[model samples]
Target: MKNLIIIGARGFGREVYDLAKQCSGYNTEYIIKGFLDDKSDALDGFENYPEIISSVEEYKIEENDVFVCALGSIKWKIYYTELILSNGAKFMNLIHPSTILNTNAVVGVGLIVFMNSNISNDCIIGDFVTIQGYVGLGHDTRIDKWSHLSAYSFTGGFVVLEEKVLLNTRATILPHVTVRKGATVGASSLVIKNVKEGTTVFGIPAKILNF
Candidate 1:
């Protein structure tokens, strides 16, 4: 079993640590080797495990070490992922044991699928994507790299979320709706139409916001 190191050392990082334990509960495949945070100050604490190690930037990569970028932002996801990859650090997909990934779904590396998230058949989940708990992706959905689906978000079949898109909590995308790159669907918004790149929408039948 490889030793796991979770990057980003914040709330999401700790969450990933707990989720990794859940993955091991059903199948003991990896042993957690504490966390490697970006800030040296973040090494000050952790509710579980003893090792704080060092900031990911200065830490030396080892052959036995595997990483999971627990960063919540797409920009950081790409940045940190590239940082680790360039340094010869390998990443592993951390899918919770309770999550349901269909047989026909295609998931890229460094993906994080939390508990209760369901990826239906024919879906394509890109690299470094974060599917939060209670999220559901219908069949044929395509989630591009560094995108995030927050808890309770639901997407209909054939929906597409481009790179760095954010589907906030409980957001619903109707069938065939495409959320372009870097857009955000506000919490509880109902997206019946396509969302343009870099726009932020909110409310029922989501409308683009000025902010």
Candidate 2:
């Protein structure tokens, strides 16, 4: 069995640890080894967590090691994962057993799907995309690489989320809406239209934030 190493050790990483236990092939297929974090004290107060193996820069790729990113920040998620990928590190997809993934859906590598997320028919999820707990995606929704859907986020049919886009907690995107690359939909926001690249939208109708 391969050893799975989680890249972050904070809140999201800790939560991923719990989710990993419920994955389909926990002990038989792969076993969790430890966490990789820059800060040594990231799990200082946490009980019953795997130890931080080393700083990201200090970790040497091992033969039995596979990785997964649990960082919440989109920028850091991309940067650190890419850094590890540069070293030819292999990654594993972590999908909670309770998630509903359609057989017609196409998923890329290094995906993290939390429990109860429903991925509908023909949904295309790109590399390293994260779907947090209770997220619901409608039919033909497309999410590009490194995008993050926070807890309780929902998207209607044909919604397109471009690379690195972040949908905060409870954000909802209407049918046929497109959120462009690097855009952020704030918590509890409703998106009824296309969002521009690199902008942040918030409020009931998700107006672009001025500052």
Clashes of each: 0, 0
Q: Rate the local accuracy (lDDT) of all candidates.
A: 0.88, 0.95
lDDT of 2 at 122: 97
- For model 1, residues 34-100, the per-residue Cα lDDT tens digits are 7887575664654455466888788898767888999888788888789889989888998987899
Name the top TM-score candidate: 2
Per-residue alpha-carbon lDDT of model 2 for 175-196, expressed as tens digits?
9999999999999999999999
Clash pairs of candidate 2?
none
In the order shown, the candidates' Cα RMSDs to the true structure are 1.6, 0.7
Which regions of candidate 2 are displaced past 4 Å? none
Against the hidden true structure, what lDDT does model 2 obtain?
Answer: 0.95
Q: After superposition, how far is residue 108 of candidate 2 from its true place, in Å?
A: 0.4
| TM-score (C-alpha) between model 2 and the true structure | 0.98
